[model samples]
Target: MPEKPPAIESFKESTKSPESELSPEVLEKVMNKVQDINEAGVAYSFVSGGPYSAGSIFEQDNLQKTKLVRILKEGLLGTPEKFYLEGVPPTKEQWAKEAQVSLRKGGRSNVYFNVTGMAHEEETPNTQSGETWISKSAGSSKKNALAFIFDLSKFTYDDDTNKMSRKYYETYYKRSTRKFTTAYGFNLSHRVPPRFFNGILLKLQDNYQYDQLAAEIGILSEQVYKEKGNLLLPIYDVYGNLYWPKKMSYEEVKKFVEERDKNKE
Candidate 1:
């Protein structure tokens, strides 16, 4: 455990008195939770107000996330009254209609479902760009919808899990407008690759050599960046981005082929 860093203290202060401020009680809970993390020796960093995000926070360990989830669920959502519940749950037909409307308006994706175990997709409104058809079951309960709200940014692989996670979490049902406002939260997870390197790697995709070298290279790359305070044998585009080369390095390409052959070993 270490003393609270100056940056972390500043973050706590800013959250306490921000333009869109949290309540004193909530702020205290947040500060305490952050202190607990620091005391537990968890490594973390925070980024605020990205275009697609409110805040982007990263931690070294998954345990930190599990602990934070419990704290937020109990602290911010302490009372049953803070949430909305349906006594007589909506009918399946009503749920489907709501889901279809939501999918149509989502813009970047289509909706898919299985009928007699055969998959079918509802077409996207705009097809100029690639759209993925994400299948989800209709929400039957508030708790289910809350769980969906919690996992909105998570990418689940299992069909059942993905379906459950993608279900809409309806917030306000405007009678006059005949519309539902859905609520969701975002978390930036560890699974995403680093910001700069992915495009180059994507071009060499399906090459086993590239996969092995990339897996082994990340640590080595970080060490070089830290010790020398410079990039390794730099190549950059007009925008000074690593992605500018527009081709995999010859050394990496050769190693990629070599590694592919050895994978048969």
Candidate 2:
């Protein structure tokens, strides 16, 4: 027999909604609405010369200080004069500083949390590890964590069914994308809160090349919640080993950890 679905109690405190006490049948209704949604591109960061290679974890002596960094900080955190950043936002500055340090010997790698909101035109084609991704977003369209939060807020869910309409998704895309534009502030009311996204962003800040891990956890968490009205596993898994974030499986994770430990020994 397969593993049973995980319980929702683990994630309920984080979700912080009365709606979280949803029945499996109701949660399934919500899953049907969101199952097909996906993002189009990968997120990344540039080191001293260019993009970091895969599996080569290292620390830099200084922040990369690219345009994407500035834009993300400003877009999500807001200007000091306008509004102070509330809740647990990702410490991009600190994250950059730490990522610049030498972690392990080099091979090939990717960043955990990439510059989220970048226009399709801003990215270069045929890019590879260690090569620079040109960011011409002097004034370009981009989606930050804030934009996603705002998008989630727009669509109201039915109290009983817990689902939204296709028309809402169409509007969300319209608001999230545009040429030479940036999303600044949209007063968030309810639905998914900022802390939810902040948790993911902060987690992303710590790892190297785990965007899929975050994405998968978010999707799976929601799917499981809807199907069983609970979480199936901790995002980091029971052993505190991050297999999915590295895009691996349980057996593969066991082998990888054993090999790593054997090498260390």
Candidate 3:
């Protein structure tokens, strides 16, 4: 039997009204920070499944200076003036403490930009899911209250398919529940292009590569929200059920998948 949809209480409606608007000047600064990190590319390690293991986990440090943390602090936390004027910027020690807090709470308390790295298992053949969301609470007046949900994936050099592995997709989809849903939120899946990971599997640091990656993300962002284009990706509900792109139910999706698999057999 198929699983039931999650209760409404599990996934609360996102906060209405922008927390704070970003001026043109501040918006530019924030984009620049995002571009910088995209260009730098994050450092990560493959655990459990090795390079080709669809179930492998990608692990990275969430330190104050790391790409993830830095992006959150500088980009979403507001400009230097805002931080300085309000109070001293959070120190490395402070960020470390907040990271723990954020992890425990499942999201940041004050800011709406949440970065989550979820690893399901400890043993071999594990899968890791990394998600970044700029919720309505981030303060954008855009029509879609929720800015976007970024699903991060790594691309390997030897993998010529240029597609996410089926196993990984299933794992990610199954694991996303309860805290994952948002009303009218756009879902954007990003696979770091192979160029950034060629030769060196650990870190990507070429200025040109970073620019390209950042541009790709920017283009995708525009395509989905700016132009209001449709990518035909399914939106998931709190129960990890398909909530959009027809059927509007997880059982329908399951039946469809089963039928397709049967046809192939």
Best by lDDT: 2
lDDT of candidate 3 over 48-163, digit per residue (tens): 11121211111232221233223322322312233333433454455446545554554322222222222122211111221112111121112111112322343122222234
Model 2 stretches with alpha carbons more than 4 Å out: 1-38, 41-120, 123-177, 180-188, 193-265
Candidate with the larger lDDT of 1 and 2? 2
Writing each residue's lDDT as its tens digit, candidate 2 over 203-257 gives 1222333334344444534443444432222223211222222323333444655
**Model 2 CA lDDT for position 232:** 27
Expressed as tens digits, the lDDT of each residue in 113-186 for candidate 1 is 11111112222111122111111112111111111111112223332322333432221111122221111112
Clashes of 1: 0
TM-scores of the models, in the order given: 0.15, 0.25, 0.23
Q: Report the Cα lDDT for residue 208, model 2.
A: 33
Q: lDDT for every model?
A: 0.22, 0.27, 0.26
Q: At residue 82, give the lDDT of candidate 3.
A: 30
Which predicted model would earn the best TM-score? 2
